[model samples]
Target: MASFAVLLRAVNIGPGLRVSSADLRGAADDAGLADARTLLNSGNLVVTPGSSGAGSAADVARLVEERLAERVGQDVSAVGLSAEQLDAIAAANPFPAAARDDPSHLQVHVPFGDLDEAGIARLDLASPGREMLATAAGVLYVHYVDGIGRSKLTPKVIDRAVGAPTTARNWNTITKLRAACAGLASR
Candidate 1:
């Protein structure tokens, strides 16, 4: 079976939609994914299923939405990734030096799509402490020297940029996810 890293979006950020890691693992297990492991509270899951090579990402996303709705009482959005995809995410880290040790720098992973120049320019991200729009391999890498919570480029900007949906993780979380994918591949 191939290794898969599922990045769940818009989960338990505040007090309202709280989903514990153990509960997330249980949901994955119930969905028939094997050896499911959760990385952190922000909904990063690494699972090895019996037929990981079988299903499409849309299928996985559907399964997660259905199960999480039942288990956590909320429909969660998930993005699935193979080992290779996760490796590419690691390699595609634009601000690698800043990402290594800085707590504020983050990587926003968006799917491959054609974002129009007009739409891209409409993003009013003139913040001083943050560097926006580092496009590499179809992924937008946003590095925030200041904390994301304080940044002006909120989730609304991201949603408009991809024109679909996007999820982000801090530099440390991205690094850990990459390492977990690598370890799973080695095994």
Candidate 2:
């Protein structure tokens, strides 16, 4: 069995993408994922694929999206990370100091694929002061020294610049994900 950290996009924030943890767990069980559990209301799930119909990381992500559509009546999408990948992502934190000292100001922008240097440059220019952007390990760590609210590095800018599906997690969430998926690495 393989463990995966599944991150669903746009969930539980408002009326448009409402979903409960119980509903998510039920749908995951139906999709042949064992030990399915959610981390928070934002749709962070960790599941181990059962001994049947298991496939690659992308395949499981598709399965989750499909099962969510079928059972939850919502076409929820997500990003999947293997245990090892999660390890790399956490280890590659360029702003460890910020993560420790000012966690709320640190944001990790995990893109589906690698982002070019030009995009990173653009993102750097977007912030006028007290902002740092580090592009590493298929992720971008944005350090907003003045807090995210004051920065103009919006998700729209990230998506347009990276030209891919990207979901961001704060330092707190990233650490939580690492802790939540630690069991997979130990196995």
| lDDT on C-alpha atoms for all candidate structures | 0.69, 0.78
lDDT of 1 by residue, 89-125 (tens): 6687767777666745676655524544445545535
Predict model 1's lDDT versus the native: 0.69
Once fitted onto the true fold, the runs of candidate 1 whose alpha carbons sit more than 4 angstroms away are 51-53, 101-103, 111-118, 121-129
Best by TM-score: 2
TM-score of candidate 2 versus the correct structure, residues matched by position: 0.90
TM-scores of all models? 0.83, 0.90
What TM-score would you give candidate 1 relative to the actual structure?
A: 0.83
Task: Tell me how candidate 2 scores on lDDT.
Answer: 0.78
* Error at 130, model 2, angstroms: 2.5
- Model 2 clash pairs are none
lDDT for position 127 in model 2 = 55
- For model 2, the superposed segments whose C-alpha errors exceed 4 Å read 184-187
Worst 10 residues of 2 by lDDT: 51-60
- Model 2 C-alpha lDDT per residue in residues 1-187, reported as the tens digit of each score: 4677788877887678887888788777888887787887888888777753756667667778888888778689877887677778788999889989999889887776667668778767875677888887777888889888767777787777776768888889878877776775456
- Number of colliding residue pairs in each model: 0, 0
Candidate 2 scores a C-alpha RMSD against the true structure in Å of: 1.9
